[model samples]
Target chain A: MNPSLKLAWVVLLALELSFTQVWTVNVVLIVICLALMIWRRVAIKRLLWLTGVPLFFASALVWSLTLQGSASHHFLIVIFTRMFVYVYLGGLFTQTTDPLTLTRSLEQNAHLPAKFAYGFLAAFNLMPKIKAEVASIKAAALMRGQVLHVWSPQLYFKAILTAMHWSDQLSLAMVSHGFVEGAPRTHAAVIPLRHRDWWLTGGSLVLIQVGLFIGLP
Target chain B: MKAWHLRDIILVTILAIFMGVIFFVIGPVYTILSAALAPAGLQPLANEILLGIWVMAGPLAGFIIRIPGAATLGELLGAVVEMFLGGVWGASTLISGVVQGFGSELGFILTGYKRYNWLTLVISALTTTIVTFTWSLFKEGYASYHLGFLAMLFTVRFISVFLFGGVLTKLITNLLSRAHVVKNVR
Candidate 1:
């Protein structure tokens, strides 16, 4: 199967699994993806970084338990399981779908304005650049004898400032490129929802509705 | 008018992912820290403060974008990212995002969507703070907390909003406005 088609199925299955709250869906997906990564000879380090999400959720659960009253064991299990599933599925979507295809699909299918869609796309593409800029800023501060720690409110403030600066530059670049509101657009690539796409989407929605009606408390 | 470009789409996707990671990591940490470290009998107050912070995101987004649905969409995007990154709140994050976004949207709407002044920001803060905290009171079972605790929480939240969400967001937007980028886009 084409990776895109498989992606559609994965998305549908994820949506269905979300409704039922059967967290095994996430576990299976993660395992399969891991297996595939190994098969494809993908880097272990990159895969490990992706697993950071689960660690994050675990920390959150521990924090929540400490701060809030002890939740039922069952509830904790459900929450953690769902978190794994949700994050992994989301990660899979990003990993599988190219940003351009995703945005093009949204614009073509949803009738979104070309400008807004592009603006949104621009924001996504800027993420790496933003990260690089933030790293440079932190390094510069460190060279000046400032320690940048996540716990420090000053660090947060600096991040906000960096984001704002980047956004300002991004908007200017967009305008210079003639990205006007309500503009007509011509795409270099066309993203059509094939028969398999419709089937996957429909199947997922149906399964979710059924699961909600039957399984939800 | 030029159409949507491949680069723009890529940017938004990356931004969403970045925001997803940040919100996912920070949101739960913030919630837990506030709930844990807040003085005993101050949970309600903490809830209020958190809600106030949550509400501020919308007005801040709106102030920066000045576009219809900017507040709601931006807040929603943030929430969605948080959820995608597997926050402790699960799907409820989406619900909170919508309500909080609406609260901020009400403030912008009340200003006839024309002004992004300090008064508008204050109103936005109040609107989001009230609605969000009210929701939190129910969601977190804050009804068990004492009245005094609730009052303290509200006060702390008011201060937090004024300082963090209100003042800080406005300052950032102002800087952006002066950067010639906002002027050019407008």
Candidate 2:
């Protein structure tokens, strides 16, 4: 599936998930998402860790509600199932799609402007550099007899300064390379919107609606 | 609204990514706090308390860029980066970003995009509180709680949003101006 289409599907379903409280629908969606993740070979270890936090939280929520006698069993189930539905759906998108490909698809197919697309791509590509710069900033702070904790404004301030410097250099380089804002640009590869993308997206939408209708409280 | 220069776009993306790191750092804290509160049936309060920090990107980006949608874009991108960093929230992260960012943008919209002062920041915080709280009323099942509990949650969330989104953002922007890094928007 095209990355853009997958993102759209995930986002829309997440929105739908938020508005409704149907545990049966939630359960069905979770199972489907789990199946998709497994079929896609999303790393099981990472998926376990990723889903575990929500599982813990969901259990805690249900336990607390049970103890308080404030929520019904169905409500508890709804809350519990809702959390995993979100995680699995999200995990499916993140684990399956490459960020670079997503960006390219957004630019090529989603009408995302070249400026925002390339801008995001540039910064997205800079995660490692930003990490290194943050570490060096902390080290430099230690050398200067100033301890920069994670929540310290000085750490972010100094780090952002370096980031601003890099942004300046980066934009300069792009402009020098003839990267014009709002200009038509060619792509090395095309991310076509296949018929299957539409079929999957539409099918999921209809299925979720049907599930919602059937599970109406 | 001025057309976004390539520099502006890059700057927002980088700063948002940086904010994402901060959000990631806060994730564990939120989990610990939520876990601690779970026994008391107050797990949701943990989100109320820490939500302000999560919203910092919207106001911070709005203040720096002084553009119409900068806050929304910054926040949305911040959520993207967080998800990229393996946040546990999944697809909800992006939706949360949209809600939060729109809330922050409302403050700037109310000001007609002219002011970038304490008032603007405070209003942004207030609007974010109202907007996000409204979202919670539906999404987080706040409607099920007692009115008093809901009121208490709202108050805590307001304070959290004010301190982090308003005051902390001011401090960062202040530092940037003092260092002659970003062109002073004020």
Chain B TM-score against the true chain B, each candidate: 0.77, 0.95
Return the lDDT, model 2, position B78: 90
Query: What digit string (tens of lDDT, one per residue) describes model 1 on residues B29-132?
Result: 56576557544423334344445445545666677556566677667766655543434343356666777788788788888777778888888878777876
**Candidate 2 TM-score, C-alpha based:** 0.95
lDDT, candidate 1, A1-217, per-residue tens: 2334544555555445544444344455557656755665655665665577556544454344435444555445555565565455555544555546756777776677776667676776665665665577669789999976433344444555555556667777877878766667788887776787668667755765664466443
State the lDDT of candidate 2 residue by residue for A1-217, as single tens digits: 9999999999999888788888888888888888888898888898788678888888876675565446666777788888888888899899999999999999988999899989999888899888777778878999989987655778778867776788899999999999988878888988999998899899879988988877575
lDDT of 1 at B167: 77
The best candidate in terms of DockQ: 2
Clashing pairs in 2: none
Q: For candidate 1, give the docking quality class from DockQ.
A: incorrect
| TM-score, A chain, model 1 | 0.61
- Full-model lDDT for every candidate: 0.58, 0.85
- lDDT measured at residue B10 in model 1 versus the true structure, 0 to 100: 33
